[model samples]
Target: MFHHRERRARTPAHETALDCLEAGITAALPKEVVSSTVDLDGKTFAVGDAAYDLDEYDRLLVLGGGKASGGFAAALADRLGSRLDGGAVVTTNVDTAAAGPIDVREGDHPTPTERNVQATAEILERAGSATGETLVLAIVTGGASALWCAPATDLTLSDLQRTTDALLASGASIDEINAVRKHCSAIKGGQLARAAAPATVVTLAISDVVGDDPSVIGSGPTVPDASTFGDALAVLDRYDIRDSVPESVVDRLERGADGELAETPDENDPAVAENEGDWHCLANGRTAIDAARDVARERGYEPLVLSSRLGGEASEVGRVHAGVAAEIAAGGDPVERPAIVLSGGEVTVTVDGDGTGGPNQELALATALELADTGTDAILASVDTDGIDGPTDAAGAIVDRESIPPDESETARRALAENDVYDALDDRSALLRTGYTGTNVNDLRVLVVPAAD
Candidate 1:
């Protein structure tokens, strides 16, 4: 799915890295996962290994929001066919057409917008209408936290927007950001499950968070919330953005912390307790990582999956990957030469410059610089499995020993300092752009080293 496939396949190692990257991305596609995991045989419907007798339910309603919700809903609709009742799904990518009875609605991502609020309202409405005999198939995936935005009654959309902006800019962990979001939102933190009370709410989730915590994914709209408003306030304080965020946000969080506002439902709450057995995670970062490793081995490289839960600052993580490559090159301690080291997980970028780039791009650029400094000949490729890195059009970037010219080293250093790796990489045609890969399982990175000469 790499758009610049020809340009990226400049060498044997680069081609292999791209192949592994494509394999990971393809394996995580929502449609493929959904179709493989969800099946229907007459009245017997199964998600994963759990089976639900369709005859036991009066109606089958779908409710969810996320980057992959559209594709997931479509795949599910195809499986359920005429047996499936009407449903609603909110997504960041609105290009996909609605299928069966699912209404695919447009929403925003990374940040919520007016359209997102409207779309989420409809989803909540659908959930609220569910009856005890209704079986609600809830789809929760990456980016749902933003796409399913519905601020609490005391807070306005603008308040949520400001708070979200501050949290993203602060480089806070996804868990922390989601902790705050669950409290500030009306539909998050198991509130959706509460709204669908008495109904059999079965959540089908594609985890993007590092640990695949169901409560953190989409802020746990269909699951129990372990975080409280006090916890949300603490996150803001920890990030030092408490005073910088909107006054409405601060006041609401303070009220919630002071017990003036009802907290989001916890695991023991009635809504969560009643439907505790309904949640299921179909795929995660490790799913893609393992698939990539298989591909690497098929390509004749000794695949080493370093970690599926790697985290930290993008540039810092890049240095760590580079260091590992250096070790492998020098003595092949980790694995023999002609090894493919793979890792998957989300990384953050503490944006200090106005430069345009995402975590994967910054990670690739930083690793390229590190490899050049240490005279290491290795190929590094990083990409967001969703095919979009930050706000840039490129999925990520790829770099090798020859990616940066000897004379342009100083110029590359300046770009990296300014967090403007996009321009630098784009100039060299190093950016890996793949429009929209129809799935997301965090980030995928591969380091390919040829046999020692």
Candidate 2:
């Protein structure tokens, strides 16, 4: 799926990293994930471990939003066939022909727009129409928070956009960002489940969070919320962006914390309690990490899954990973030579400069600096499995010891400091581009260490 594979795969190590990435991403593709996790029998429909009697429910409706939702919705439509009734799903990618009976509507990401708001209304309306006999299959995945935008009472689309911009720029974690977003939206944090109350809602999700907490994934539209308005406000305060966000957002959060407004549904809420066990995480970062590890073994390299729940600043994480690779390369202390170290998690970039680059690019660039400084021969590559990194067309970047030449090391460092690694990586033909891979299992990093001569 990488468009510039020919230009980027300069060595065996580079090719191995790319292979591992492909294997990891392919394992999490919505269609592949669904085919393995969901099934239909004579009269029972199964997703994960949950089974529903098709004869008991009068109608089965699909609803959700995310970067991966289009492929997921389409796959579900193909799986359910005529047994499935019509439903709406908002996503950045639209494939009407593939979506079959499901309405795959277009929506924006990173920031919510009027289009997202309107599309979300349709989902909420359809969900609200469900009866006790109706089965609602909520397909929540990464980016759903933005695609499933539904501003709360007295909130406008502009209000949400402004608040989202502030939170994104504040370097807040996904959990922290979703905490604030859930309180400001009408369908997030179990509100969608509340709307479809008594309808036997079942959430089939592809997790993008570090822990795969259903509430944090897609802001928990079909699951109970563990965060509160007080927690959201605390997140803003922790990031020191309380004053940076819109006044309406602060006011709504403050009021909700004061008990003037109802909080997002909790476990005690009847709607959430009824569907407690119905939420299932079909695939997550670990899923991708494991698949990549299998590829490493197949390629004759001893694979080490460093950690599947990695977190923290992207550049810092990159440096630490580089240190580990250096250890393996120099003394073979970690796992001996010819090792492949794989990890998956969502790393954040505290955006300070106007330069364009995503977390994966930043991490890869930072790792390149360490590898160059230590003269490590290992090849390091990182990518957002969704295929888009930051606002750039490149999924991420691949780097080796020579990626940043001795003469250009300072310039490369400056580019990273300015959040401008995209152009720098592009100049070296190191940018890894794979247009939308139709899935997001957070960020995947691969370190391919060659055998010692």
Candidate 3:
């Protein structure tokens, strides 16, 4: 699915890295995952290892919001066909038309908009109307936190927007950002489970968060929220942006924490306990990484999966990856030469300059600089599994020794310092632009090193 695949694979190592990346991304595609995990046989429907008798339920309703919700819903609908009564899903991909009984509504991502608010309201309404005899299929995936926007009664859409902006700009981790989001949102943090209480709600999730914590994915709309409003307030305080955030946000959180308002359902909550066994994660970062590993072996490289939970500043992570590559190239301590190092997880980018770039681009640029400084002959590539890195059109970027010569090391350093890696990579045709890849498991990084000449 890498659109500029031929152009990006300039060397044997680059080709191997791209091949591994494509394997990882394709493994996590929503359609493929859903079709493989869900099956129907007359009145018997099965998801994963669990089976349900369709005849027992009066209606089958689908409801959810996320980047993959559209594709997931479409795939499920293809299997259920007329069995699906009616439903609604919110998503950022507006290009894909609704293919089945489920209504696909447009929503925003990374930031919630008025359209997101409207579309999410419809999803909540459908979820709330579910009965005990109704079987609800919930698709919870990455970017759902922003796409499923449903502001609390005390807060407006603007209040949520300002708080979301502040938290994202603060370079907070996804868990921390989601902690604040759960408290501010009406449909998040197990509230959707509350809305669909008594109904047999089955959630099919494609995890993007590290550790695959159900409570963090899509801000845990279908699962219990272990975090409280006090925790949300603490996140803002930890970021040191509580005062700068919208006043309404602070007041609402303060009131909720003070016990004047109801808190999000925790593990003890009845609705959460009832559907605890129903939540299933069909795919995750490891699922993608495993696929990459097989491709690496087939390509005659020793694949070393460093970790699937890698996180931290994008550039700092790049430096670490560079160090490992240096080790392999110097003496092959970790493994013999002709090794493919892989890692997966979300990375954060602290925007200090007005330059345009995402975490993956920044990491690739930083890795290029480090490899040049250490005189390592290796190639590094990083990309968001969703095919959109940050707000840029490029998925991410690839860099190597040839991409950044010795004379241009200082220029690359300056570009990285200004967080303008996009411009530099664009000029060199190093950016990987694949449009939307129809899935998101997190960020994937690949370092390819050939045997010593």
* Candidates 2 and 3 compared by lDDT, better number: 2
Q: What's each prediction's clash count?
A: 0, 0, 0
Candidate 3 residues lying further than 4 Å off, grouped into runs, are 95-98
Candidate 1 lDDT for residue 124: 89
Which candidate ranks first by lDDT, i.e. highest? 2
Residue 232 displacement in candidate 3 (angstroms): 0.6
Give stretches of model 2 more than 4 Å off: none
Residue lDDT tens for model 1, 344-451: 999998877888899999999989989999999899999999888998899999998778888998998888878888999999889999887888899999999888
lDDT of 3 by residue, 306-353 (tens): 999999999999999999999999998698889999999999988778
Report how far off residue 293 is in candidate 3 (Å): 1.1
Of candidates 3 and 2, the better by TM-score:
2
Model 2: lDDT to the true structure:
0.91
Q: TM-score for model 1?
A: 0.98
lDDT by residue (34-148, candidate 2, tens digit) is: 8999999978998766788999999999998999999999999999999999899998878889988899999988898888988999999999899999999999989999999
What do the candidate models score in CA lDDT, each in turn?
Answer: 0.89, 0.91, 0.90
